[model samples]
Target: MDPLTPMITTNPFDDDKLREECGIFGVSGADTASAIVALGLHALQHRGQEAAGITSWDGHDFHTHRAMGHVAGNFDRDEVIRGLPGGSACGHVRYSTTGETSLRNVQPLYAELNSGGFAVAHNGNISNAMKVRRELIRRGSIFQSTSDTEVIIHLVATSSYRTLLDKFIDALKQVEGAYSLIVMTPEGMIACRDPLGIRPLVMGKLGDTIMFASETVAFDVVGAEYIRSIDPGELVIVTNSGEIRSHRPFGEVHPRPCIFEHVYFSRPDSIVDGSSVYSVRKAIGAQLAIENPVEADYVIPVPDSGVPAAIGYAQESGIPFELGIIRSHYIGRTFIQPGDKVRHLGVKLKHNANRALIQGKKIVLIDDSIVRGTTSLKIVQMMREAGAAEVHMRIASPPTKHSCFYGVDTPERTKLLAHKLDVGGMQDFIHADSLSFISIDGLYKALGEAKRADGRPQYCDACFTGDYPTTLTDQDDVVVTNQLELLAERVA
Candidate 1:
């Protein structure tokens, strides 16, 4: 059997891409904080679906509910919303990594610190969390959950600082990685982004209440007016009386927000980092067309994720855009119940080639990315089966050659098809007539930059460039441990 066969390379149910870290939302000074948080979390559900949580502080006590499931199933009921009562609240939607998807790791993780109660909703991964966790444990700190977010709570609990704000600042100074945090204390709500701002966090307003969310789309969902982003290294403290204070205690550094948000993580309507996500994607597609033009009868998107780029490609290339492929979003999760073989064959259950529109047409297929190359293989096969004369593939982003450590859950380096193969090899493996990816410079140009600065830039492109801004202490420690064990065996 050929190793590169479509059956071997594809999975009908698997997207083979990076999963978003988490989405965090908070509202301070709102009358119905928890209820408004539910609506906001529902809007940001696309960010995560594995688990959801919300915590509310009503002047005296903090109330919380954490569950493993979509926000729609777990947080939509009026009774559930009523259980969490307060004028200030925060919530989180998480996509836990495989083998770590337990309810105990759900966010809005709470603790009874010396300063009353403290709860935090986090939207990033701490690269040095495990290293800090080991040290904290050695110092006799009892752990509650396996999540990295728990580290912040323990850090706050043990801080020598007198005030809650000081303790939080102490914690932020010690750890490293991407984080956009919404922390709730008895007195007020605290929102802060990491020094480099590798994650997205925005501030909005609904009347007198202040809102903090991972994206601007949540503001639209909850009827909030977009304000501006919480600048990297900056902290904004919102008091119970609606008093807001801003501080830049982390000092100055090159703020590198995640570029992937504009490419795929954020909703099309979202305005992230002062630019429209849809507009960035369209520009990416246009750049791709200018960089890699091909003659075809029609241009077709892979659907949903690929639509914006495809539209830009079609317009820029002067090719007619048509519905060459149709997607069935309703076929989610249900495909897993039919067993592996059925699931693989049923990739068509979710996406099928539009035979009528595609027949005899030479088409250019546009997609946001190709993670493991599996979906591309299947989509190309489906196009051929639908009587398409030629299928030329164009990717909106550069090949994702490195796995992400800043909260995004991605396949290991060995499993990444792009990391394992060159461009020609990928084209052969995916069975496309021609394949091209937007150059890294092209990607930056689409984001309205002349080109990404090699040493300093506006956003994190670590997945493509492999030039990580922070020290991956946890990952490096694991590698060191493995090397030590190998040396010990050789000595024996």
Candidate 2:
């Protein structure tokens, strides 16, 4: 297949939701390091579901295993883990936001550098990857994969710095955007986060072994003690002999971690940025209730992602909480949609309204966010079909008016419902009796802030506020290229 051509997965039911970026896990100073990394990746499966890969340095040689699917089917087998014999290993689970969904893009992307063998597992987007790629190509750097992650490897390979650590830091300095990376080399394992820290990464320990993962919840899965988050712009290196070192190659800068993790991306059980995700979500729902109270008989969640907030909303609004929608846990991720008829019935296969419970009831539906508004409209229509007297919609997060350049796979600015429509217009489009979203200030309040401060808010709320923390050099280049093409067309 052509590397430039995108291989799109058609899932009508999930298309309206923002796609997860990726997950990374690493372990050093353990005999069964690859096995432990597999367990950590299993716990972080929600972050990415399309593909998984692991790379291990077994004393003298590097061993790698990669597949296009979930961690269970590919990595759980005894034979697979035994093949990756090493004391240090790093793994990645990926959902393609910057590359095609293929085996070639599955990472823990590895290379044989002049210094030694290097493998990297990254969990974020590089905003300036294309600009750097063009420059590298001009300088005779041959790229093996179309993934932006591969750009880091090439940069490190071509750097003029004398030491591997300095070369790694040099490569990082040229890139823009979020990254939480776990890198494995012959000498040691290196874990680091980008300067602005738009993504999340945490450290943990089990006996003498040190582990790194995208979330603390991964540590819990593998029976590791939570250490702490890898600080923004900080690099932690664990040597072959268990000696550890810390470096801050990037100077001090205010961190701006992604705020959406609390709203939707992260598992509720995970702790992010020293805050419980479940607690933050519940607080967000309570804030939503205070800002948009309504007369309703029952408060219902959209299910799974919306449950914690729904409970908080019901408690705050003095309404009974009920599971008005039931989700089918048996539905497989690869369930086939034979045709348009089957595709249109996809929502029913996954979620069905509780007709008996919701009949003749005034219900309020709580959801994380509205992307295209298609899912919200269908859900509201389903509630009405179940004999709901009234259906009101409440969103836990503020309007997602802008596209995310940092890792998340969001629809374009024009495709987002909030970007094109106001609150009233969105309500009309969804056919909801009432529609409301938590104000940006209310969202911050839920996170224990009075409100969002004037400039440089506490977190990276770029998707909601259109205030990107990094320079989008790639996106800017695309805009310029498009303008040039249009001008050439006019002249022709």
Candidate 3:
């Protein structure tokens, strides 16, 4: 899981279908924690694309710098980071899930409370946010942002607990959903994982320095010794004295690591616990070759995220891998745009089929996952125009039939191609010669043996299996209201 090495063994064709949320990194050390975290966040910019933010804590006060762009673009020089002046810092790169893509939703959310402390930075979604907001309003709390994460600040501020940790625990108890939070405060830095382990949080150390991040990749960037995951429902508090206290409010709940993380979200070099995301993804492609083998002259990856799996598929299926599409490195992300025309144009401008390699060849196109059918359709059309004899599409993950409220931006079920059509039906819709999705069982096997601390084996397939770990109400207004009221009173 060394970040120095990438797992991809072949060239891949980058496409628009693979989308991911951003990454987070936090550090508590002797000096320039904000600058260190900025570097760490830069290493993790691949996890998110919309925005980047950093919050630092000097002994007397907290300073934050945030902007809407890549880390390198936003925080290019040391002076930008040095200006913050804090020994404890938390940084985030955000891909919006709630509201519009504006500075308003950019994370490392800061609130200066009556407690004379600054609370900043949180990750993941609150399914009960609408309910929580309602509750906060009933108690006279005003919200300045549309993000669900703001509820956490209000909750912590209003809690009756005497200590900050106790207040956080109480605030968390009232909300339900996926979250892996890193909070920077005057007292210290706190890291916590959700009860279901739906998102990842890991802790690492470099001598007296303590670091936390959404992925282990950050540890690699900061030269910190890799520590294991922060366990489902576990909380670790690092104080000014460097004493670390770990708490498990929800002990050993069956961990359901977000399957999508392994499939497409996390860095290929990051090892989640003992699991190698790269190896698991390759296994997924290999397993796809076994269960859903197709006849094609060559195998092609959808690029960037799709390469490793495509290599495994090619190796297992006895097909040679080739770069059938060349992705334009200069183009901005396909999903980021001011209008539908721009977004659509981005897809075509970003990828151009290699007519020399693709012409008159039976092509097996492998991709991570498909959300809306639009991107796939355009891609298929691209391959066809390039004179492909036949295009057989292979997906490395199970069909996504449900929306992800936990932060990955997926459309509603009806908009999902697999939700309405089976493999055969999807083939017709996308004009592919054939189509196959890796089985859920195959996805599990590819991820390698799953072993729970209690000796059970399981995973979260909520997007595909619809087995949500927590229940969020359908009454959106009521849910946000209740959560808001409860959080406001608890924090106030």
Candidate 4:
């Protein structure tokens, strides 16, 4: 037989689910900062798998290692780890929510400025990046990378502040949007979240080494003791002497962190905002089951991401839980399809119907969210093929009607299935006997809220509610701005 050719297409599973943002990890005052950071980045590989980079400051010089692949592939080598000898380091795993996938855009972006050497690894988009980029260009602020993150460097360089930390604080005041930054300087490390805390960042410690990461899972990876999450607008600096200082540079404001973290982005075993991610997902399912009860023989999950919700749904509805679909662990975002025949197989490559359980059963299928309805449509058909008498689809989240601008790689709103189709239309498009999503209020209840507060929401639900917290300056001009995002690499 001819060798099964590996194919490259976004058709498989990448479109069915929401693409994740980047993950950042940093550690200071460690004997092997680079190696531990590598491990932490490896744990956060799910956040972004496109590229990985780390920058380390070893007192005498700064070392950086950036590669366009998974951390497991590149950072696993001792040779690679040995190249970065330092007592403090910051690293990032890229998923390309902003800039194109290029070596120049890979981050832990290092720049030698008037304040000495500085490196930054960031999570979340700078919504006004273009506006600032334009202003910087006019004033002769030469930028290196295409990423909005580089804008911070220019701001810092141009600031008249006396200290590096002050320059960073002044620079942050000028930018608007969600960000969780892990910045490394020769003096030590500085970590902070945006004023609204739209992205998640946590702090921890392993021995005398201080740690910072986008998620607690990174802390788990490197055996770091869990510390409190970095408060919104709070900045912490770890000095070369291992002494830590805290600063609240931004003015008082109610922080609204991203709600989607509980819905999908975070690891199930991880704890976020003092709540267990797994428990929250289960609660979401229970709420979904209560609001949308159905007569079904089995509660089946879409697998992996959907399992917790399915379990909760089963417990709440008194329906037996069954693994109706078995997912293949090998399925990845990108793979080489043999040809059109394999490409057409679609959901089968990633998931398959457990015919023995699915056959002759009326099933309620639980999924975290329906991004495009492509996978749902295919999975419903698969159940029918397996002799399922009926398939009732239950979504754990409210309808994802709007594209995310904070960092997630969401398709255009016009392309969102929920944006164009009402609930009835969505049910019909997916060809399910019945379909219902958890209400916005129901979703809030799952997160321990009585109901969603319209006046001052607990979290950013812009993707579901279209209630954006910050102004989208770079996104206002769709054509010219999107062109700038796609074509522009740097400003000089």
TM-score of 2: 0.97
Badly placed stretches (over 4 Å) of model 2 are 1-9, 97-100
Misplaced by over 4 Å in model 3 are: 1-18, 97-100, 334-345, 450-457, 474-492
- For model 3, residues 153-269, the per-residue Cα lDDT tens digits are 899889999987788899999998878889877778889888888888888888889999888888888788888888889989899879899898875587777888898888889
Task: Order candidates by lDDT, high to low.
Answer: 2, 4, 1, 3
Global Cα lDDT for candidate 1 = 0.88
The clash numbers for all candidates, in the given order, read: 0, 0, 33, 3
lDDT of 4 by residue, 315-377 (tens): 999999999999998976567755766665867888999999989999999999998888899
Q: Worst 10-residue stretch by lDDT in candidate 2?
A: 1-10
- Candidates 2 and 3 compared: the better one by TM-score is 2
lDDT digits (tens) for residues 290-360 of candidate 1: 99999999999988899999999988999998888899878654245666656566658778898998899
Model 2: lDDT of residue 164 = 96
Tens-digit lDDT track for model 2 on 65-114?
99988999899999999999989999999875434456877899999999
Residue 12 displacement (Å), model 3: 21
RMSD of each: 4.1, 1.7, 7.3, 5.6
Judge candidate 4 against the unseen true structure and give its global Cα lDDT, from 0 to 1: 0.88
Clashing pairs in 1: none
Candidate 4 ranges beyond 4 A from true positions: 1-11, 97-100, 337-341, 479-492
